[model samples]
Target: MFSFNDLLTINGISPQDVAVALHKPANTSERQALCTMIDEDFAAFNAYQSTHARIPEATLKARGIMASFVMTSDGRMTFVGLFANAGSQPFAQAGPHVYALFVRMTRKMTGPDEVNGRSGLEALQNRLLFDLSRLDTMSDLSGRLIVQDPGARNYMRVADCTPLPVVELTKEAQMTPPVPNWDALVLTAPDLRKLPNSWRVQLSAWRGVYLIVDRCDGARYVGAAYGSENLFGRWSQHVAREIGITKELSQCDPAEFQFSILELLSPAATADEVIGAERKWMRRIGTLEFGLNT
Candidate 1:
């Protein structure tokens, strides 16, 4: 029979503080009215629970995570919530858990009206779906339960499963004669800043070394690196050093460039083995190829 006001009191939060944090109108009179509405809503929920007694324990547990509410410019209000599991604790501690919930509530509260034109109810449903989706994505739970649903096959058919577009590389100048039966190495670095945010590093790394090249526009020669913490920096340095090498070898020269990391294998792995794995993974999840001019 615990109400939201009671929960807030237990958590040491006040309705006025919630309104101010949520950026609700600073008008004291309006703030008091909203708090009264919230109290009434909680009282009704408590009455409903007394009659039905059907609320799930998980739902009650989730309520504890919502710390505040925010009113959007369009009059929609959102409830902010948070969840903490072991893996996320480190990142969460870096910021205020309550503030994060406020941001979430602000985003959800401002959306369009739903069925019956009830903003609060619709926002709550959307928040629930958002939380459920996060749990589903992170959990190791298989789709077996979903598959058992009556319309499972129909649902699967409606789901889109398309391949990502591939970036094509042209062989302009073969400065270094291709090694006979050499394995192509693919490496990936998710954090490369210069490359298009969408562009992932895909190259082969073998024997503690890897080659990177320009996949887009093909205007630069590529370089290789070994045992570097900032592969992007090392690759850039290689490009600068090799700018002259490419110009000297191929008079019709484009600038040499460093490759980003998309796929990298430690020195312990064989080049051929890494290339094979790279090809398999790329086939499944599309990757860009880097030119290894250096």
Candidate 2:
């Protein structure tokens, strides 16, 4: 049958000094591209060997050669990184560690299927998280290469040279200004639960006028938030109920709804001021006359 040896032959590498054959499959295109990038960028390092070597004594040396292969989640092989540097540490034990690399997939890799499954928090927790601690669940790096280091080994080369995507947390994002135009913040119904705590906190801090446009039709709804609950709190209420308070939104599929903040009000703004802004927006947008703000 096909084996690692066959894989090596296909790639034109002699399989003699190989320490281990590692195969990890990345199901998404984003991941597939990363595999290619890591291999190309680190080719020289991957080719270096220990002192008992024939090649030039290079600055970077690989402890052992490893063949990294990536495939789709369904097992369709896509990319491979031959002889990638095995990081010093093999498995992570605890977290709050910064991931050197990461990618934002179109959907969570660890959750249940949308069609026949409940979209619950627990299901979301099942996906591969950036801050990983468990080794058994290494499936999160499903299509990436991993080595057990059969023996405790160290290479003279650079450590942790894997190309990892930089991650900017929600708190870090808050340090930057919000969208210059407040209305630029848009969300789909499914996006609400995924909001980071920092983002939610910032949203809840603002009492604002917002719009929900039904993309299915060109109809829109203008609304306001001025109560003890701010924009975030109001959105949380919308997340709970399918229809919300608007008949048009309730009748339309959640996928057809796009939510945006039209205006931000000061925390000290009175209820009258918030509603007045909402009404003015509704009048300007003609939502009350032809849209969904009854």
TM-score of each: 0.22, 0.45
**Alpha-carbon lDDT, every model:** 0.29, 0.46
lDDT score, candidate 2, position 234: 81
Write one digit per residue (lDDT tens) for candidate 1, span 196-267: 211112212222223344444443332333433334445433433323344322432223223333455564
Encode model 2's per-residue lDDT on 1-294: one tens digit a residue.
334344445555455534332223233433332233333333211211111122212322233344333332233332233343333321132122212111112122221123232222232332322111112222223233222222222222222332222121122211112332456677755555445444566787889899887777767888898876698788766656556555656776655567789889899999999999999999999987798776
Error of 1 at 260 (Å): 8.1
The true-structure Cα RMSD of candidate 1 reads: 21.5
lDDT of 1 at 183: 48
Model 1 TM-score, 2 decimals: 0.22
